[model samples]
Target: MNEIPLEHVHVAPDDGVEDDPAPAVFVLHGRGADEEDLLPVAAELPDDHHVISLRAPDRLQDGYTWYELDLSAGGLESSQPDADDFRRSLDLIVGSVEAAVDAHGLDADRIGLLGFSQGAITSLSLLLEDPDRYAWVVALHGYLAESHADLDPDGIGGKPVFVGAGAGDRVIPQSRTEAAIDHLEALDADVTSGSFPGGHGIGPQELDAVVEFVASRTA
Candidate 1:
């Protein structure tokens, strides 16, 4: 398959990169953020692992976005650009995974994903599209796509998912959060989630939780 031509930033450990296969995590930034924006958080992960931060396929102002949205419906709604962008985004992720596996011999069982906002939605959507491909997922301030329900649900059982939500988030509706949680649960994912004090942002507390979850999965 021809993978999407998306630019990305990668962080890898100094030692054993060529000699051993390590766990790999793909980090995704929110809308209006570049691949470099999420590098700090990716640094918090285990140093023995490979961290890949990807730039979105399309530019949105000075930064980039995986998808676009339309809030004209009084709430955020998926625009056609959003869905089309996702198809390309998912292809990028899959292609990256293939390259990682081939080049570094990274374990398929240890590959995971982490995303914030639009990135989060992209990560989750990719998992739903190919549930068996990713070992775990971390979604921050994201919602499920309407088409997610139409996908087959058999492959997601026992997959770990961590969702970090802002308790006071007015940017994303509570219903969307609830629906994502409920849908993941219905799909038999081992979902772990908590609400932080901020809105549409990640704090130290949420970061700690995310680290814990990633640790559990990576270890």
Candidate 2:
């Protein structure tokens, strides 16, 4: 499998990387943001971990989108890309995570994912579909794809998942966020949700919550 090509930035501990397998986090950017966008968020994370931020497959006119969206209905509509292309992207991400873990000699069980907006949606879909691939998931301002209802979390077990949403998010509706939370909890995920005072973006309080969630699960 091909590695997920990530435009990355790394932050190391004062003691430097150890010989042991280090934990890692794969950061996915939102639509219209390249790999560089969310990589900065890694600074808020533990320095002991290797961090990766990946670009979506296709470029939009100004930014990028994971898969094409159909707006014929006057609003965003989900459309599945060609099966092969979608699967290939997923495989690439999985391979990249796997390779990074092996390269760092880090334990596979400690790998995690953090995504914002469109990236968050992608991470949730990947986790729901693949099962047991991540130690935890940080989905910020995102949704569970309608396709996710087909998943059975029995295969993935009880991996912790944290979601941060905004009461005034125009991109991803709050109602939709609630629906996704319901679905995930139904599938038996150890899920936590926090809504903050903001719009389609993150605020200080929300960021703190996310930091706490990641630290709690990974530590």
Candidate 3:
């Protein structure tokens, strides 16, 4: 079957938080999740940063997925190796982000990326591809495919990056998560790694840590 074109859109915050010129945090949801699925996490954020959640565009059943999958024994996707496609999606996201920054008079240097599952893969790739585009990256419960290892991300442009995973995850193992951390560290990226006690999902502990990590960097 021919591949469908990808699309993405922004989800502003709930709770009526006024958009400000301070800074923005882009939120990416996991596979089978919509743009608003993870809004609660963004809304729970302690800081008053502008929260932007983007849809992955590819529909799978009722939810959405960023890329195709090969749901076998392990949680790995079939490697299409579509580097160009990935670049285009990243470009689109960055373009919209630029417009948002301009409209709100935000400091572009303070923009950050946050994602979960499939969204985590995209978020990490964005920082690796363009380190200066974000002030930091927060990846939660995601794995990096072998194809991503070939790209040199220039070490996060001296920005901080935090990776969190569940030690008892069913889909993602601890080793894969650790290897991702090693890869980022090898690139001279400032990285912090942590593990929670759950399985393939974000718990309160993970959220608390993520909130603290983001707040410290933005402060």
lDDT of model 1 at position 106 = 68
* Structural similarity to truth (TM-score) of each candidate: 0.90, 0.87, 0.83
> In candidate 2, what are the lDDT values of residues 46-135, reduced to their tens digit?
777777676777778776667665444466533333445456666667777776665555568777899888778878888997767788
Instruction: Report the C-alpha displacement of residue 139, candidate 2, in angstroms.
Output: 0.7
The digit string of per-residue lDDT tens for model 1 on 54-148 reads 78877989999887775444545333235566677778778877776666566777788999988888888888888788889999988887656
Residue pairs clashing, model 1:
none
**Which candidate do you rate higher for lDDT, 1 or 3?**
1
Q: Model 2, residue 15: what's the lDDT? A: 76
Better model by lDDT, 1 or 2?
A: 1
Displacement of residue 83 (Cα, Å) in model 2 is 6.3
Question: Candidate 1: where are CA atoms >4 Å away?
Answer: 1-4, 14-19, 70-73, 77-81
Q: After superposition, how far is residue 173 of candidate 1 from its true place, in Å?
A: 2.8
Using TM-score, rank the candidates from best to worst. 1, 2, 3
TM-score of 3: 0.83
The 10 consecutive residues of candidate 1 with the worst lDDT sum are 72-81
Q: What is the C-alpha lDDT of each candidate?
A: 0.79, 0.74, 0.74
